[model samples]
Target: MNQSMFIVWRESVEALLVIGILQAWISQQSQSHRLSKFLWSGVLLGLLLSGLLALLIMFAGDAMSGALNEWFQAGMALIASLLMVQMVGWMHRHGRSLKQDLQRHADQHLARRGGLGLMLLALLAVSREGSETVVFLYGAGARLRGPELGLFAVGGLLGLVLSALTIVLLHSSRRFISWRRFFALSEAVLLMLGAALLVSASERIGGQLLAMNLPEWVYGSVGDALWDSSHWLNDSHGIGGFLAGFAGYRATPSALTLAVWLGYWLLIAGWLRQRREEPLPCLG
Candidate 1:
Protein backbone atom coordinates (compact mmCIF):
# COMPACT_ATOMS: atom_id res chain seq x y z
CA MET A 1 0.00 0.00 0.00
CA ASN A 2 2.76 2.39 0.89
CA GLN A 3 4.66 1.64 -2.28
CA SER A 4 1.60 2.17 -4.42
CA MET A 5 0.87 5.45 -2.68
CA PHE A 6 4.34 6.83 -3.16
CA ILE A 7 4.53 5.75 -6.77
CA VAL A 8 1.22 7.41 -7.58
CA TRP A 9 2.07 10.57 -5.69
CA ARG A 10 5.41 11.02 -7.35
CA GLU A 11 4.23 10.24 -10.88
CA SER A 12 1.04 12.27 -10.55
CA VAL A 13 3.01 15.27 -9.37
CA GLU A 14 5.22 15.02 -12.43
CA ALA A 15 2.26 14.66 -14.81
CA LEU A 16 0.57 17.62 -13.18
CA LEU A 17 3.75 19.65 -13.49
CA VAL A 18 3.86 19.00 -17.22
CA ILE A 19 0.23 20.04 -17.67
CA GLY A 20 0.80 23.13 -15.54
CA ILE A 21 3.70 24.21 -17.70
CA LEU A 22 1.74 23.79 -20.92
CA GLN A 23 -1.32 25.51 -19.51
CA ALA A 24 0.72 28.43 -18.23
CA TRP A 25 2.21 28.92 -21.66
CA ILE A 26 -1.20 28.65 -23.33
CA SER A 27 -2.54 31.38 -21.07
CA GLN A 28 0.07 33.75 -22.48
CA GLN A 29 -0.96 33.18 -26.09
CA SER A 30 -3.56 35.13 -28.12
CA GLN A 31 -5.95 32.15 -28.61
CA SER A 32 -5.65 31.19 -24.98
CA HIS A 33 -9.20 29.86 -24.61
CA ARG A 34 -9.07 27.62 -27.68
CA LEU A 35 -5.62 26.32 -26.87
CA SER A 36 -6.69 25.51 -23.34
CA LYS A 37 -9.47 23.36 -24.72
CA PHE A 38 -7.09 21.44 -26.95
CA LEU A 39 -4.69 20.92 -24.05
CA TRP A 40 -7.44 19.54 -21.80
CA SER A 41 -8.72 17.24 -24.55
CA GLY A 42 -5.25 15.83 -24.89
CA VAL A 43 -4.89 15.29 -21.16
CA LEU A 44 -8.18 13.41 -21.01
CA LEU A 45 -7.23 11.21 -23.94
CA GLY A 46 -3.88 10.42 -22.35
CA LEU A 47 -5.56 9.41 -19.11
CA LEU A 48 -7.93 7.12 -20.99
CA LEU A 49 -5.04 5.43 -22.73
CA SER A 50 -3.29 4.90 -19.42
CA GLY A 51 -6.42 3.28 -18.02
CA LEU A 52 -6.44 0.85 -20.93
CA LEU A 53 -2.85 -0.08 -20.21
CA ALA A 54 -3.69 -0.83 -16.58
CA LEU A 55 -6.50 -3.13 -17.67
CA LEU A 56 -4.24 -4.89 -20.14
CA ILE A 57 -1.65 -5.60 -17.47
CA MET A 58 -4.27 -6.87 -15.07
CA PHE A 59 -5.69 -9.27 -17.64
CA ALA A 60 -2.25 -10.53 -18.59
CA GLY A 61 -1.40 -11.25 -14.97
CA ASP A 62 -4.64 -13.09 -14.47
CA ALA A 63 -3.92 -15.27 -17.48
CA MET A 64 -0.55 -16.47 -16.23
CA SER A 65 0.17 -19.05 -13.50
CA GLY A 66 3.04 -20.83 -11.77
CA ALA A 67 6.54 -20.30 -13.19
CA LEU A 68 5.42 -18.01 -15.96
CA ASN A 69 3.75 -15.69 -13.46
CA GLU A 70 6.82 -15.63 -11.29
CA TRP A 71 9.04 -14.82 -14.22
CA PHE A 72 6.68 -12.09 -15.41
CA GLN A 73 6.52 -10.50 -11.98
CA ALA A 74 10.30 -10.56 -11.64
CA GLY A 75 10.71 -8.99 -15.05
CA MET A 76 8.26 -6.23 -14.20
CA ALA A 77 10.04 -5.51 -10.92
CA LEU A 78 13.39 -5.31 -12.68
CA ILE A 79 11.98 -2.94 -15.31
CA ALA A 80 10.42 -0.73 -12.66
CA SER A 81 13.68 -0.47 -10.77
CA LEU A 82 15.62 0.46 -13.88
CA LEU A 83 12.95 3.00 -14.85
CA MET A 84 13.15 4.63 -11.42
CA VAL A 85 16.89 5.05 -11.73
CA GLN A 86 16.55 6.44 -15.23
CA MET A 87 13.83 8.85 -14.10
CA VAL A 88 15.94 10.19 -11.26
CA GLY A 89 18.95 10.72 -13.50
CA TRP A 90 16.90 12.33 -16.25
CA MET A 91 15.21 14.69 -13.79
CA HIS A 92 18.52 15.67 -12.26
CA ARG A 93 19.86 16.59 -15.70
CA HIS A 94 16.78 18.37 -17.09
CA GLY A 95 14.69 19.65 -14.18
CA ARG A 96 16.22 23.13 -14.16
CA SER A 97 15.25 23.75 -17.76
CA LEU A 98 11.96 21.80 -17.80
CA LYS A 99 9.73 24.82 -17.76
CA GLN A 100 11.69 26.58 -20.47
CA ASP A 101 11.83 23.47 -22.63
CA LEU A 102 8.10 22.87 -22.37
CA GLN A 103 7.41 26.44 -23.39
CA ARG A 104 9.76 26.21 -26.31
CA HIS A 105 8.13 23.06 -27.56
CA ALA A 106 4.69 24.56 -27.14
CA ASP A 107 5.73 27.53 -29.26
CA GLN A 108 7.10 25.35 -32.01
CA HIS A 109 4.05 23.11 -32.04
CA LEU A 110 1.67 26.06 -32.17
CA ALA A 111 3.59 27.64 -35.00
CA ARG A 112 3.77 24.44 -37.02
CA ARG A 113 0.32 22.97 -36.47
CA GLY A 114 -1.61 25.23 -34.15
CA GLY A 115 -4.05 23.61 -31.70
CA LEU A 116 -3.55 20.12 -33.11
CA GLY A 117 0.16 20.22 -32.51
CA LEU A 118 -0.31 21.52 -28.97
CA MET A 119 -2.83 18.76 -28.30
CA LEU A 120 -0.47 16.07 -29.55
CA LEU A 121 2.33 17.41 -27.36
CA ALA A 122 0.14 17.34 -24.27
CA LEU A 123 -1.09 13.85 -25.16
CA LEU A 124 2.41 12.43 -25.49
CA ALA A 125 3.70 14.10 -22.33
CA VAL A 126 0.82 13.01 -20.09
CA SER A 127 0.72 9.50 -21.59
CA ARG A 128 4.41 8.99 -20.86
CA GLU A 129 3.95 9.81 -17.19
CA GLY A 130 0.66 7.94 -16.91
CA SER A 131 1.97 4.77 -18.58
CA GLU A 132 4.95 4.77 -16.23
CA THR A 133 2.65 5.02 -13.22
CA VAL A 134 0.66 1.97 -14.33
CA VAL A 135 3.78 -0.15 -14.75
CA PHE A 136 5.25 0.99 -11.46
CA LEU A 137 2.06 0.30 -9.55
CA TYR A 138 1.70 -3.17 -11.04
CA GLY A 139 5.31 -4.03 -10.27
CA ALA A 140 4.99 -2.80 -6.69
CA GLY A 141 1.62 -4.34 -5.84
CA ALA A 142 1.48 -7.48 -7.99
CA ARG A 143 1.60 -9.80 -4.97
CA LEU A 144 -1.17 -8.08 -3.03
CA ARG A 145 -4.65 -9.60 -2.94
CA GLY A 146 -8.07 -9.41 -1.21
CA PRO A 147 -8.18 -6.63 1.40
CA GLU A 148 -4.60 -5.71 0.73
CA LEU A 149 -5.48 -4.96 -2.87
CA GLY A 150 -8.29 -2.70 -1.75
CA LEU A 151 -5.89 -0.82 0.46
CA PHE A 152 -3.53 -0.46 -2.46
CA ALA A 153 -6.25 1.15 -4.52
CA VAL A 154 -7.18 3.45 -1.66
CA GLY A 155 -3.57 4.44 -1.24
CA GLY A 156 -3.30 5.31 -4.92
CA LEU A 157 -6.36 7.53 -4.71
CA LEU A 158 -5.03 9.21 -1.60
CA GLY A 159 -1.77 9.82 -3.37
CA LEU A 160 -3.52 11.52 -6.26
CA VAL A 161 -5.34 13.80 -3.84
CA LEU A 162 -2.18 14.54 -1.92
CA SER A 163 -0.33 15.37 -5.12
CA ALA A 164 -2.92 17.97 -6.04
CA LEU A 165 -2.63 19.51 -2.58
CA THR A 166 1.14 19.48 -2.82
CA ILE A 167 1.13 21.30 -6.13
CA VAL A 168 -1.17 23.94 -4.71
CA LEU A 169 1.01 24.43 -1.67
CA LEU A 170 4.24 24.62 -3.67
CA HIS A 171 2.80 27.16 -6.09
CA SER A 172 1.30 29.26 -3.33
CA SER A 173 4.22 29.44 -0.92
CA ARG A 174 7.80 28.46 -1.73
CA ARG A 175 8.87 30.06 1.53
CA PHE A 176 7.93 26.82 3.19
CA ILE A 177 9.40 24.43 0.58
CA SER A 178 11.03 25.21 -2.70
CA TRP A 179 10.83 23.05 -5.84
CA ARG A 180 14.52 22.15 -5.53
CA ARG A 181 14.04 20.90 -2.00
CA PHE A 182 10.97 18.88 -2.99
CA PHE A 183 12.71 17.19 -5.92
CA ALA A 184 15.82 16.48 -3.84
CA LEU A 185 13.83 14.75 -1.10
CA SER A 186 11.71 12.80 -3.59
CA GLU A 187 14.82 11.73 -5.53
CA ALA A 188 16.36 10.26 -2.39
CA VAL A 189 13.20 8.29 -1.63
CA LEU A 190 12.97 7.10 -5.26
CA LEU A 191 16.52 5.72 -5.15
CA MET A 192 15.65 3.76 -2.03
CA LEU A 193 12.50 2.44 -3.66
CA GLY A 194 14.52 1.40 -6.68
CA ALA A 195 16.84 -0.54 -4.40
CA ALA A 196 13.91 -2.35 -2.82
CA LEU A 197 12.52 -3.33 -6.21
CA LEU A 198 15.89 -4.65 -7.34
CA VAL A 199 16.15 -6.73 -4.18
CA SER A 200 12.69 -8.19 -4.86
CA ALA A 201 13.65 -9.12 -8.41
CA SER A 202 16.88 -10.71 -7.21
CA GLU A 203 15.08 -12.78 -4.56
CA ARG A 204 12.63 -14.13 -7.10
CA ILE A 205 15.37 -14.98 -9.56
CA GLY A 206 17.48 -16.53 -6.83
CA GLY A 207 14.57 -18.72 -5.73
CA GLN A 208 14.15 -20.08 -9.23
CA LEU A 209 17.88 -20.71 -9.62
CA LEU A 210 18.16 -22.41 -6.24
CA ALA A 211 15.39 -24.80 -7.17
CA MET A 212 17.36 -25.97 -10.21
CA ASN A 213 20.01 -28.74 -10.15
CA LEU A 214 22.92 -26.47 -9.34
CA PRO A 215 26.14 -27.27 -7.48
CA GLU A 216 26.20 -27.34 -3.66
CA TRP A 217 28.40 -24.27 -3.45
CA VAL A 218 26.17 -22.31 -5.81
CA TYR A 219 23.11 -23.26 -3.74
CA GLY A 220 24.83 -22.28 -0.52
CA SER A 221 25.86 -18.93 -1.86
CA VAL A 222 22.53 -18.10 -3.48
CA GLY A 223 20.11 -19.48 -0.89
CA ASP A 224 21.84 -19.58 2.49
CA ALA A 225 21.60 -16.64 4.82
CA LEU A 226 24.91 -14.98 5.69
CA TRP A 227 23.80 -13.99 9.19
CA ASP A 228 20.55 -13.66 11.11
CA SER A 229 19.59 -10.20 12.38
CA SER A 230 15.91 -10.79 13.16
CA HIS A 231 16.70 -10.61 16.86
CA TRP A 232 17.63 -6.98 16.41
CA LEU A 233 14.96 -6.07 13.85
CA ASN A 234 12.72 -8.64 12.22
CA ASP A 235 12.07 -7.83 8.57
CA SER A 236 8.79 -9.76 8.35
CA HIS A 237 6.75 -7.52 10.60
CA GLY A 238 6.34 -4.03 12.14
CA ILE A 239 8.86 -1.26 11.40
CA GLY A 240 11.37 -3.68 9.93
CA GLY A 241 8.85 -4.88 7.37
CA PHE A 242 8.18 -1.28 6.37
CA LEU A 243 11.88 -0.70 5.94
CA ALA A 244 12.18 -3.87 3.87
CA GLY A 245 9.44 -2.71 1.58
CA PHE A 246 10.65 0.88 1.29
CA ALA A 247 14.43 0.64 1.51
CA GLY A 248 15.54 -2.97 0.79
CA TYR A 249 16.35 -3.87 4.38
CA ARG A 250 16.85 -7.64 4.82
CA ALA A 251 17.26 -9.18 8.27
CA THR A 252 18.35 -12.53 6.79
CA PRO A 253 19.78 -11.68 3.39
CA SER A 254 21.55 -14.18 1.15
CA ALA A 255 24.76 -13.43 -0.76
CA LEU A 256 22.86 -12.55 -3.91
CA THR A 257 20.64 -10.05 -2.12
CA LEU A 258 23.60 -8.34 -0.51
CA ALA A 259 25.49 -8.14 -3.78
CA VAL A 260 22.56 -6.59 -5.62
CA TRP A 261 21.91 -4.06 -2.87
CA LEU A 262 25.54 -3.01 -2.68
CA GLY A 263 25.89 -2.76 -6.45
CA TYR A 264 22.81 -0.57 -6.76
CA TRP A 265 24.08 1.98 -4.27
CA LEU A 266 27.58 1.96 -5.73
CA LEU A 267 26.25 2.73 -9.19
CA ILE A 268 24.04 5.48 -7.79
CA ALA A 269 26.98 6.98 -5.92
CA GLY A 270 29.14 7.08 -9.04
CA TRP A 271 26.31 8.60 -11.06
CA LEU A 272 25.74 11.32 -8.47
CA ARG A 273 29.42 12.14 -8.33
CA GLN A 274 29.54 12.54 -12.10
CA ARG A 275 26.43 14.74 -11.99
CA ARG A 276 28.00 16.93 -9.32
CA GLU A 277 31.05 17.59 -11.44
CA GLU A 278 28.90 19.09 -14.21
CA PRO A 279 27.75 22.68 -13.75
CA LEU A 280 24.04 22.86 -12.92
CA PRO A 281 21.74 25.46 -14.38
CA CYS A 282 19.93 27.93 -12.13
CA LEU A 283 16.64 26.52 -10.85
CA GLY A 284 14.72 29.76 -11.08
Candidate 2:
Protein backbone atom coordinates (compact mmCIF):
# COMPACT_ATOMS: atom_id res chain seq x y z
CA MET A 1 0.00 0.00 0.00
CA ASN A 2 2.76 2.43 0.91
CA GLN A 3 4.66 1.43 -2.19
CA SER A 4 1.64 2.22 -4.34
CA MET A 5 1.16 5.54 -2.59
CA PHE A 6 4.79 6.54 -3.01
CA ILE A 7 4.83 5.48 -6.64
CA VAL A 8 1.69 7.47 -7.39
CA TRP A 9 2.88 10.46 -5.39
CA ARG A 10 6.25 10.68 -7.13
CA GLU A 11 4.78 10.19 -10.58
CA SER A 12 1.94 12.63 -9.93
CA VAL A 13 4.36 15.36 -8.90
CA GLU A 14 6.32 14.86 -12.12
CA ALA A 15 3.25 14.86 -14.35
CA LEU A 16 1.87 17.90 -12.56
CA LEU A 17 5.21 19.68 -13.00
CA VAL A 18 5.04 19.18 -16.74
CA ILE A 19 1.46 20.40 -16.90
CA GLY A 20 2.30 23.32 -14.65
CA ILE A 21 5.16 24.38 -16.89
CA LEU A 22 2.99 24.35 -20.01
CA GLN A 23 0.08 26.02 -18.26
CA ALA A 24 2.33 28.71 -16.84
CA TRP A 25 3.71 29.38 -20.29
CA ILE A 26 0.23 29.56 -21.78
CA SER A 27 -0.88 32.00 -19.10
CA GLN A 28 1.93 34.36 -20.08
CA GLN A 29 0.87 34.40 -23.73
CA SER A 30 -1.47 37.00 -25.29
CA GLN A 31 -4.08 34.59 -26.69
CA SER A 32 -4.21 32.38 -23.66
CA HIS A 33 -7.87 31.45 -24.07
CA ARG A 34 -7.32 29.88 -27.49
CA LEU A 35 -4.36 27.77 -26.42
CA SER A 36 -5.90 26.69 -23.11
CA LYS A 37 -8.34 24.38 -24.89
CA PHE A 38 -5.53 22.67 -26.78
CA LEU A 39 -3.47 22.32 -23.62
CA TRP A 40 -6.37 20.65 -21.84
CA SER A 41 -7.00 18.49 -24.89
CA GLY A 42 -3.42 17.30 -24.88
CA VAL A 43 -3.63 16.51 -21.17
CA LEU A 44 -6.80 14.51 -21.66
CA LEU A 45 -5.29 12.68 -24.60
CA GLY A 46 -2.13 11.85 -22.70
CA LEU A 47 -4.27 10.63 -19.80
CA LEU A 48 -6.26 8.51 -22.24
CA LEU A 49 -3.04 6.97 -23.51
CA SER A 50 -2.10 6.12 -19.94
CA GLY A 51 -5.56 4.67 -19.31
CA LEU A 52 -5.34 2.50 -22.41
CA LEU A 53 -1.94 1.26 -21.31
CA ALA A 54 -3.31 0.32 -17.89
CA LEU A 55 -6.20 -1.55 -19.50
CA LEU A 56 -3.87 -3.31 -21.91
CA ILE A 57 -1.59 -4.41 -19.08
CA MET A 58 -4.50 -5.68 -16.99
CA PHE A 59 -6.01 -7.61 -19.88
CA ALA A 60 -2.64 -9.01 -20.85
CA GLY A 61 -2.03 -10.17 -17.32
CA ASP A 62 -5.42 -11.87 -17.24
CA ALA A 63 -4.83 -13.51 -20.61
CA MET A 64 -1.75 -15.37 -19.47
CA SER A 65 -1.56 -18.35 -17.11
CA GLY A 66 1.08 -20.46 -15.29
CA ALA A 67 4.73 -19.83 -16.07
CA LEU A 68 3.86 -17.49 -18.90
CA ASN A 69 2.14 -15.10 -16.55
CA GLU A 70 4.98 -15.24 -14.05
CA TRP A 71 7.49 -14.57 -16.78
CA PHE A 72 5.45 -11.72 -18.18
CA GLN A 73 5.04 -10.08 -14.80
CA ALA A 74 8.75 -10.49 -14.17
CA GLY A 75 9.52 -8.89 -17.49
CA MET A 76 7.21 -5.97 -16.76
CA ALA A 77 8.75 -5.44 -13.31
CA LEU A 78 12.26 -5.62 -14.72
CA ILE A 79 11.45 -3.12 -17.45
CA ALA A 80 9.76 -0.85 -14.93
CA SER A 81 12.77 -1.06 -12.65
CA LEU A 82 15.17 -0.18 -15.46
CA LEU A 83 12.96 2.69 -16.51
CA MET A 84 12.83 3.95 -12.91
CA VAL A 85 16.61 4.09 -12.80
CA GLN A 86 16.68 5.87 -16.12
CA MET A 87 14.06 8.30 -14.95
CA VAL A 88 15.86 9.14 -11.71
CA GLY A 89 19.29 9.27 -13.28
CA TRP A 90 18.03 11.46 -16.06
CA MET A 91 16.42 13.84 -13.60
CA HIS A 92 19.44 13.87 -11.30
CA ARG A 93 21.68 14.79 -14.20
CA HIS A 94 19.26 17.23 -15.85
CA GLY A 95 16.82 18.53 -13.22
CA ARG A 96 18.91 21.68 -12.94
CA SER A 97 18.22 22.49 -16.58
CA LEU A 98 14.68 21.09 -16.97
CA LYS A 99 12.90 24.38 -16.36
CA GLN A 100 15.13 26.19 -18.84
CA ASP A 101 14.64 23.48 -21.43
CA LEU A 102 10.86 23.54 -21.06
CA GLN A 103 10.77 27.31 -21.23
CA ARG A 104 12.98 27.33 -24.33
CA HIS A 105 10.75 24.80 -26.00
CA ALA A 106 7.70 26.87 -25.12
CA ASP A 107 9.34 29.98 -26.58
CA GLN A 108 10.30 28.16 -29.76
CA HIS A 109 6.87 26.65 -30.23
CA LEU A 110 5.03 29.86 -29.46
CA ALA A 111 7.32 31.85 -31.74
CA ARG A 112 7.53 29.64 -34.86
CA ARG A 113 4.28 27.65 -34.93
CA GLY A 114 1.46 28.34 -32.52
CA GLY A 115 -1.35 26.11 -31.20
CA LEU A 116 -0.49 22.77 -32.77
CA GLY A 117 3.13 22.99 -31.75
CA LEU A 118 2.19 23.80 -28.16
CA MET A 119 -0.37 21.03 -28.15
CA LEU A 120 2.14 18.50 -29.38
CA LEU A 121 4.68 19.72 -26.88
CA ALA A 122 2.19 19.34 -24.06
CA LEU A 123 1.10 15.98 -25.42
CA LEU A 124 4.63 14.58 -25.47
CA ALA A 125 5.43 15.87 -21.98
CA VAL A 126 2.25 14.56 -20.40
CA SER A 127 2.41 11.27 -22.26
CA ARG A 128 5.97 10.59 -21.17
CA GLU A 129 5.18 11.17 -17.50
CA GLY A 130 1.87 9.28 -17.72
CA SER A 131 3.56 6.31 -19.37
CA GLU A 132 6.12 6.17 -16.59
CA THR A 133 3.31 6.22 -14.01
CA VAL A 134 1.54 3.38 -15.78
CA VAL A 135 4.67 1.26 -15.82
CA PHE A 136 5.43 2.00 -12.16
CA LEU A 137 1.86 1.27 -11.03
CA TYR A 138 1.63 -1.90 -13.10
CA GLY A 139 4.78 -3.24 -11.51
CA ALA A 140 3.39 -2.54 -8.04
CA GLY A 141 -0.07 -3.85 -8.96
CA ALA A 142 1.26 -7.35 -9.50
CA ARG A 143 0.93 -8.21 -5.80
CA LEU A 144 -2.30 -6.37 -4.99
CA ARG A 145 -5.90 -7.60 -4.80
CA GLY A 146 -9.37 -7.00 -3.23
CA PRO A 147 -9.37 -4.50 -0.32
CA GLU A 148 -5.72 -3.83 -0.87
CA LEU A 149 -6.63 -2.88 -4.40
CA GLY A 150 -9.11 -0.40 -2.97
CA LEU A 151 -6.35 1.07 -0.84
CA PHE A 152 -4.15 1.24 -3.89
CA ALA A 153 -6.84 3.17 -5.76
CA VAL A 154 -7.47 5.48 -2.84
CA GLY A 155 -3.78 5.91 -2.34
CA GLY A 156 -3.38 6.88 -5.96
CA LEU A 157 -6.10 9.51 -5.78
CA LEU A 158 -4.70 10.83 -2.54
CA GLY A 159 -1.25 10.98 -4.04
CA LEU A 160 -2.55 13.05 -6.94
CA VAL A 161 -4.30 15.47 -4.61
CA LEU A 162 -1.44 15.73 -2.18
CA SER A 163 1.18 16.10 -4.89
CA ALA A 164 -0.70 19.00 -6.42
CA LEU A 165 -0.79 20.67 -3.05
CA THR A 166 2.92 20.00 -2.63
CA ILE A 167 3.67 21.54 -5.99
CA VAL A 168 1.72 24.63 -5.12
CA LEU A 169 3.48 24.97 -1.80
CA LEU A 170 6.91 24.33 -3.24
CA HIS A 171 6.41 26.84 -6.04
CA SER A 172 4.95 29.44 -3.68
CA SER A 173 7.90 29.10 -1.32
CA ARG A 174 10.93 27.62 -2.96
CA ARG A 175 13.18 28.98 -0.24
CA PHE A 176 11.41 27.05 2.52
CA ILE A 177 12.00 23.78 0.72
CA SER A 178 15.29 23.54 -1.10
CA TRP A 179 14.39 22.43 -4.63
CA ARG A 180 17.70 20.65 -5.15
CA ARG A 181 17.44 18.68 -1.90
CA PHE A 182 13.79 17.92 -2.61
CA PHE A 183 14.68 16.46 -5.98
CA ALA A 184 17.69 14.65 -4.56
CA LEU A 185 15.52 13.05 -1.89
CA SER A 186 12.84 12.18 -4.37
CA GLU A 187 15.40 10.55 -6.62
CA ALA A 188 16.81 8.57 -3.69
CA VAL A 189 13.43 7.24 -2.67
CA LEU A 190 12.63 6.43 -6.28
CA LEU A 191 15.89 4.50 -6.71
CA MET A 192 15.10 2.48 -3.58
CA LEU A 193 11.68 1.66 -5.02
CA GLY A 194 13.31 0.66 -8.28
CA ALA A 195 15.61 -1.71 -6.46
CA ALA A 196 12.62 -3.26 -4.71
CA LEU A 197 10.97 -3.84 -8.06
CA LEU A 198 14.16 -5.40 -9.39
CA VAL A 199 14.25 -7.77 -6.44
CA SER A 200 10.59 -8.57 -7.00
CA ALA A 201 11.26 -9.38 -10.64
CA SER A 202 14.03 -11.70 -9.54
CA GLU A 203 11.57 -13.46 -7.24
CA ARG A 204 9.11 -14.02 -10.06
CA ILE A 205 11.82 -15.17 -12.44
CA GLY A 206 13.25 -17.47 -9.79
CA GLY A 207 9.85 -19.05 -9.27
CA GLN A 208 9.62 -19.72 -12.99
CA LEU A 209 13.10 -21.20 -13.02
CA LEU A 210 12.30 -23.50 -10.13
CA ALA A 211 9.14 -24.62 -11.93
CA MET A 212 11.24 -25.72 -14.88
CA ASN A 213 12.73 -28.59 -12.83
CA LEU A 214 16.27 -27.30 -12.96
CA PRO A 215 19.21 -29.17 -11.42
CA GLU A 216 19.38 -29.79 -7.66
CA TRP A 217 22.11 -27.20 -7.10
CA VAL A 218 20.11 -24.56 -8.98
CA TYR A 219 17.08 -25.31 -6.86
CA GLY A 220 19.13 -25.22 -3.68
CA SER A 221 20.70 -21.89 -4.53
CA VAL A 222 17.41 -20.31 -5.59
CA GLY A 223 15.14 -21.90 -2.99
CA ASP A 224 17.14 -22.28 0.19
CA ALA A 225 17.47 -19.33 2.49
CA LEU A 226 20.84 -18.35 3.89
CA TRP A 227 19.36 -17.53 7.28
CA ASP A 228 16.05 -17.00 9.06
CA SER A 229 15.50 -13.71 10.88
CA SER A 230 11.74 -13.74 11.09
CA HIS A 231 11.88 -14.48 14.78
CA TRP A 232 13.49 -11.13 15.47
CA LEU A 233 12.19 -8.94 12.67
CA ASN A 234 9.03 -10.30 11.15
CA ASP A 235 8.57 -8.93 7.64
CA SER A 236 4.82 -9.54 7.33
CA HIS A 237 3.69 -7.16 10.06
CA GLY A 238 4.62 -3.99 11.95
CA ILE A 239 7.42 -1.60 10.91
CA GLY A 240 9.40 -4.39 9.35
CA GLY A 241 6.63 -5.09 6.90
CA PHE A 242 6.55 -1.43 5.92
CA LEU A 243 10.27 -1.47 5.34
CA ALA A 244 9.94 -4.77 3.47
CA GLY A 245 7.36 -3.32 1.12
CA PHE A 246 9.47 -0.20 0.65
CA ALA A 247 12.84 -1.91 0.22
CA GLY A 248 12.25 -5.57 -0.73
CA TYR A 249 13.09 -6.93 2.70
CA ARG A 250 12.79 -10.64 3.30
CA ALA A 251 12.97 -12.62 6.52
CA THR A 252 14.69 -15.46 4.80
CA PRO A 253 15.97 -14.70 1.34
CA SER A 254 17.41 -17.19 -1.10
CA ALA A 255 21.01 -16.91 -2.29
CA LEU A 256 19.91 -15.84 -5.75
CA THR A 257 17.65 -13.13 -4.34
CA LEU A 258 20.42 -11.78 -2.13
CA ALA A 259 22.88 -11.81 -5.00
CA VAL A 260 20.56 -9.96 -7.35
CA TRP A 261 19.63 -7.35 -4.73
CA LEU A 262 23.28 -6.61 -3.91
CA GLY A 263 24.37 -6.78 -7.52
CA TYR A 264 21.88 -4.08 -8.59
CA TRP A 265 23.51 -1.49 -6.31
CA LEU A 266 26.99 -2.41 -7.44
CA LEU A 267 25.90 -2.07 -11.06
CA ILE A 268 24.35 1.33 -10.35
CA ALA A 269 27.50 2.57 -8.62
CA GLY A 270 29.62 1.52 -11.57
CA TRP A 271 27.27 3.21 -14.02
CA LEU A 272 27.34 6.45 -12.00
CA ARG A 273 31.12 6.36 -11.98
CA GLN A 274 31.18 5.87 -15.74
CA ARG A 275 28.77 8.73 -16.28
CA ARG A 276 30.87 11.08 -14.16
CA GLU A 277 34.04 10.25 -16.05
CA GLU A 278 32.52 11.05 -19.45
CA PRO A 279 33.33 14.49 -20.92
CA LEU A 280 30.53 17.04 -21.21
CA PRO A 281 29.84 19.58 -23.94
CA CYS A 282 31.70 22.84 -23.31
CA LEU A 283 29.62 25.79 -22.22
CA GLY A 284 32.11 28.01 -24.05
Clashes of each: 0, 0
Mind giving the per-residue lDDT tens digits that candidate 2 earns over 5-120?
78788888878887887888789989999999888888888888888888999899999998889889999999989998999777756676777788799889877888877887
lDDT by residue (tens digit), candidate 1, 10-60: 999999999999998998999999999999999999999999998998899
Off by over 4 Å in 2: 273-284
- Specify the poorest-scoring 10-residue window by lDDT in model 1: 275-284
Which 10 successive residues of model 2 have the least lDDT summed? 275-284
TM-score of 2: 0.93
After superposition, the stretches of candidate 1 with alpha carbons farther than 4 Å from their true spots are 278-283
In model 2, the clashing pairs are: none
lDDT, candidate 2, equals: 0.82
**TM-scores, one per candidate:** 0.96, 0.93
